[model samples]
Target: MKINRCGQAEALTKEMFQKVLGEIKNDSHRLIFALCWYTTERPSAILQLQVSDVYGSARVPLEKMVIAARTRKDKKTREVPIATALRQELKAYSAPSEGYLFPGRAGHLTFSAYDKGLRRVFEKLGLRGFSTYSTRRGSLTTLSRSGAGIRQIQALSGHASLGNLQRYIEVSDSEVAAIAAML
Candidate 1:
């Protein structure tokens, strides 16, 4: 099974999100997953984020919450903005502007380490096949199904094109059955 398709892509009902958040032992881990769900950014981009990227004068109206990060992917830099939920979580974990958002033991956020942690979390939660990337896919899929247009999703997800964005949204057999029933 595709790692991204491991489980339900629905936005992890508020209760489930809270449950998973509660299971996290540390604030950093909670912030990591919260940021992932809010930004819908890839693990690499998220791990690459630095404190400066989230702050700085360039981040205008910072008090309004929701900051954008310049992500380097596909030979281009795409700006992805955070959501309100993530902003609040970030505020709670606020670190110095020169440090890493999710610092590792070595003092830098590493995608490999983060992925491993996420895997363990999934295992402990008895969820199979789901990977860290599932957060991105889940966020995008949820947004798409909730009446968000392709362009809006592409912008928020930093996808270069609608085609690329569509690939992340997996319409399952259950959805098809529901649609047929409606018809």
Candidate 2:
């Protein structure tokens, strides 16, 4: 399988995200896109999120979301902490406790549907070879380049090994040029 490089994935412009969000007619779709982009979660994990997994009171600002995920890759359950931006987005599109985070027409989200949505978004943007996994890769790349350590990223992303984490960190040509400029 061809994995998306971190550099190319991070290169996903804000305009692209906005365009995709705008194209989504349903409130649920927009919310799902926001969650995926903000949390850097795999579609499978994202699909499994429940309203109860989010821990914040209505009295307080919904800025923090606690996501409990059971990843097939890791075969372990992990909790991911998301920031206010994503939390606020989710709150804006809040669903009932029994509802799926990204409910489909059938009333529950599926991995295949999530994958198709991501592919459609990329296709609309004229970006080929991009997949939902790119979101996770982009998140890891952004954090790593921002000075986060492998251990930190591993913890946040639930990767089993540093080697797997390293695969997500793509050194870009711009980065190379920037470094050369300093020399």
Give per-candidate clash totals. Answer: 0, 1
Error of 2 at 97 (Å): 3.1
Question: Alpha-carbon error at 37 in model 2, in Å?
Answer: 2.6
Q: How would you encode candidate 1's per-residue C-alpha lDDT over 67-89 as one tens digit per residue?
A: 33444466555555656666677
Give the deviation of candidate 2 from the true structure as CA RMSD.
4.1
- Candidate 1: list runs displaced more than 4 Å: 2-16, 56-71, 105-107, 181-183
* Location of the lowest summed lDDT over 10 successive residues in candidate 1: 59-68
lDDT of 1: 0.67
Model 2 lDDT tens row, 1-183:
344533334434445566766776667656767666676666676776666565344523244455553434566666666676676766577576554556667756777776676677677777765666666676667787888888988887777888977887767899999999998
Per-prediction RMSD in angstroms? Answer: 4.0, 4.1
C-alpha TM-scores of all predictions: 0.78, 0.75
